[model samples]
Structures are given as structure tokens and as C-alpha cells.
Target: MFDVLQVGQQHGTSTDRSRIGAEPVLLSLSPTIVGSRGGAMVTMRSGQAAQAALREEHWQEMERFGDFLTDEDLAALPQTIRDGLIGVRRPGGMRYPAFQIVNWGDGTKEVPPAWLQLVELLAPAGWNDEFLILWTSAPNAYLEGASPAQTIQSFPTEVTAELRYAAERAIPTRPGGPGSWQ
Candidate 1:
């Protein structure tokens, strides 16, 4: 949690309240933008901190999850936004599209060369996003739930994730046992 604003102002300030000699009173503040103010402090208890909260179970699950995918399977994941796999992973459902990066030339069954269109795919955890073709050679996938589109054709580049895949990356605990390469 973060205190939007904490100012010591005068409690009894009439209509003509000025920055003159007035008693100190706690001021309620709501920040329009986070981390913007005078000595703003964000406090969180243990096991609640963003970094520490990632439980060990989630990490182990992801490690096991990673093992299922072969090098070819990992490499087979959609590299382009227009091209994504038919089935990936879902919590309870059968399958879902997992955002990934792939090459355009390396056409697969799901995405053919003719169907090279800018598309959207959910990121890890859950996200409303669009897949973008980074440089023609190496494309990177990103999720955009707040904005309108996926590609950052606008002036300011937007690279932010509204959701997360939980322990897929942060835990560092291997999932899926081992890959074929290993």
C-alpha cells in the first residue's frame, strides 16, 4: 500500500486559507499518478511483497509444466502475433493460446504464410493483448489490456503487462522436469 499524499496543513483554514502561519494538520491525498509526491513510501508486509509473494508451489508447477514442451515444441510456439498455437494451457479449461515468438518464414499448420495479419493473444496469467512483429528477424510478444492495440505505432512505446502468468518466470524453480536437449 502507498500513501497517495501526506501533508501537514492547517486544520482550521477559513475560505481565505493561505500558506501563512497555520497549525499542522494531516492532509488526505489521492495520487493521480503513483510514486509521484514528496517522499512517497509504499509499505507492504512480508509474504505480501511483490517479490516475496511468489510461492514455491507455483514455481514447482511451472517447472513441471516446462518439461512437457520439447525443444521443438518450445521452438514451435508462435513467434508472430498473427500466428499462434491452437492449444497451449489453461487453468481448468482444455487449452488456451499462449503468447509466443516465432519466425514468419517458418510457417506452421495454424498460421500459414497467406494469413499474416496482426492479431491478439493473451499473455501468461490472463491478459487482453495483441501480438506484434518486432524486427522482421526476431519478434517479441506483449500483452495490452489497457490500450486499444498491440503494436506501438504511436510515438511513445508502451511495454507494460496488466496480467501475469504467476510463477512461470519469477520462481526460478524448474518445472516440467527436463527438456529433450537437457
Candidate 2:
């Protein structure tokens, strides 16, 4: 069984703490478990600390994608190419992830055709940009613990197959007619 961390009341004055309410909440992520006579002791960050850590981790992960293209930067590209790129909403505005772009020594950049194909496969799901980004970057069980973004370059076929399966799963199907009770 997975170890669980029980977080007590937060110590900070930030309003984010109130969101956790008066009760201590349990979390399973990154828990530190220790054996004791009673049972076990689990240590974890407070709500505020966990939130801060999550924000920092998100910022660092976004940094790994290289430079994010702003509206002005994207406007420099042709409309067709711009439309094919994946852009996520941020605090300021829409920022395009440049992971698909291959930069040449001459300063020109090109988006891989395979990346566009992957985007096309996921388009029918109508997932938001943030979800798309997370889905690609996060470790997927369907991909055997490898993130789609990590293996897409070397294992395009496998990634494509997984994406197709995910798309099919996302489609809602009715088991029977709406009027039917059983």
C-alpha cells in the first residue's frame, strides 16, 4: 500500500491556507514514512508549502521547453504554421510551447511534421492546452511509464498508437438509449 501523509494546520498568514479548512488533510505524493511502535509516521509539507513547491516545479518544467513564444513572436510566423502550434493560456496571455521547433544555425526554426500529426490526433479530444501539455509531458501508463513527449522523437509510432487509443477512450458512448431504463 502507498504511504500517506497527514498535514496539520498551516502556519503561514497566506489565504491559501484557509482553502484547506480546519481539518488536517492527507496526501500521498512524496511522503516520508517512518516505522513506529504505534504504526507509522508520515511527514509532508503543509498546504502552503506544497502549493509553493508545485508552483516552482511547474515553472521549472515549463523552462525545460525552452523559450515560450508570445503573441508577437507567433505573429511573425505564417498563419498556417501558427495555427498548427500548441499554445497554452498563461497569466499574461497565450504562450506557445516551442518544444516542437528545431532551431538551425542560421536562426531559422522548423516544426516537425510528426509533432503536427500528434497534435492532429489529439485535436478531436478537445482537451485544453494545459491538459494537452500535461498529457504529453507526464508519465503515462499506456506508454509504459514513458512520457509521450519524451519518447515521441524516438518512438513516434508507439506514441501515435497510444494517442489514438486515448482519443478513442475519451469519446463518450452510450450503453443504451436514453429512454431505456435497463
Candidate 3:
């Protein structure tokens, strides 16, 4: 588990009168964004700091008749959004990123806004969903060790900034010219 020292003031002032101080308060954070001020910290009970889990390249079936999503739901998305999905093939068959599908119950589903934006940004940069899935799920230093997916769901603004930073970092610089390759 990793400990992210969050200064409360860095986020924003809270109206709650019970808080310790008006200034920043150091918080122990976790893997997922907790409350607005505190986050769920990954446990480090083993004495050694826990690292973010490495993502494997394998894909899950987009049409899996499972609780996550179904074939009919995938068919219901707008064509443009549907086309934007990254497809991969393993020995089994074509599959999509499991993270892209959000189950809202009653068989309803939605793709996250942050996720869609990241896909749009990365597509022009020659980055694919395979890269996106891994990158977004992996722990990020900019997010204070939180994964992009986790940050996006709770702290929307922070995630957008992180995305912009990523785009800037991914832009290729020419040897002597100002223009980027893409």
C-alpha cells in the first residue's frame, strides 16, 4: 500500500465545522479516491509498500453474456462511440477493455466521460485501447499514485488536467522544427 499525503487546502476549503484546521490537513489516501478530502489508502501491512498491479495484455469478450455487459447493450451504443472502441484478438476471439463498460443495473451501461476523452486524445497519437487500458488502470504519479480510472470517477477536474498533461507528454518534438508529428 502507498501513502499519499494530501494537504486538504490544496483541494479546497470545506464547510464542515468538525474538520481539524482551516489550513491543509495531511491525509492518508488509498487506491481509490475516498471522500473529497480523504482517499482510501492501499494497505501496507506487509512492511513493504505495495505497488500497483501490472496489467496483462489479455482481453475480455465485449459480448460476454455476463453481469458486466451483454451483446445487445454493445449494439445499442451510438455508431461513432462504438467504432471508437479498441478491438483485440487473443486465441479465443475479439475482445474489448473490461473497464470501458460500466454496469448501471437493469442491463444498462455507459462509458465513462474521462475514458472517452482519453480515447479521443490518444487515438490521434497512434495509441490504442490496449495502451489506454493499461495506462489508465496503472497507478500515476500525477494522481498522487491513484489510477486514472479512480481519479476520473471521483475527482473529474484533476483527471482532465492529468489527461492534458499526458497529451502534452506524448506529443513528439521534431529534431529542429516546432511542429509535432501528430
Best by lDDT: 2
In candidate 1, position 113 carries an lDDT of: 21
Which of 1 and 2 is the better model by TM-score?
Answer: 2
Tens-digit per-residue lDDT, 1-182, candidate 2: 33444466434343557677765544344444333334765444455457656755774577666547888888888776676678777667887766556555688666656567777767766777776776676676767787666656554333367755654454344455332234
TM-score (C-alpha, index-matched) for candidate 2 = 0.48
**Residue 122, model 2, lDDT:** 70
Taking the tens digit of each residue's C-alpha lDDT, what string does model 1 give over 1-182?
A: 34344465433424446745676544333322233235865444332454333433433343456522334454644465323434333343323222223233455333322213222222222322211211111223323232212222221122223212211232233444221122
Model 2, residue 156: displacement in angstroms? 6.5
Error of 1 at 178 (Å): 41
Ranking by TM-score: 2, 3, 1
lDDT of each: 0.31, 0.61, 0.52
Candidate 1: the clashing residue pairs are 62-175, 63-174, 63-175, 63-176, 64-175, 64-176, 67-176, 79-101, 79-102, 125-165
Off by over 4 Å in 2: 1-60, 64-67, 103-108, 155-159, 162-182
Model 3 C-alpha lDDT per residue in residues 1-182, reported as the tens digit of each score: 23344545344344567766776544433323223214644434222222222233222322343213233445777665466455554445555555565445577655666667766666665666556666666667766788666666664333377656755555455654322544
Question: Scored by Cα lDDT, where does model 1 land?
Answer: 0.31
As for model 1, its CA RMSD to the true structure in angstroms is: 17.9
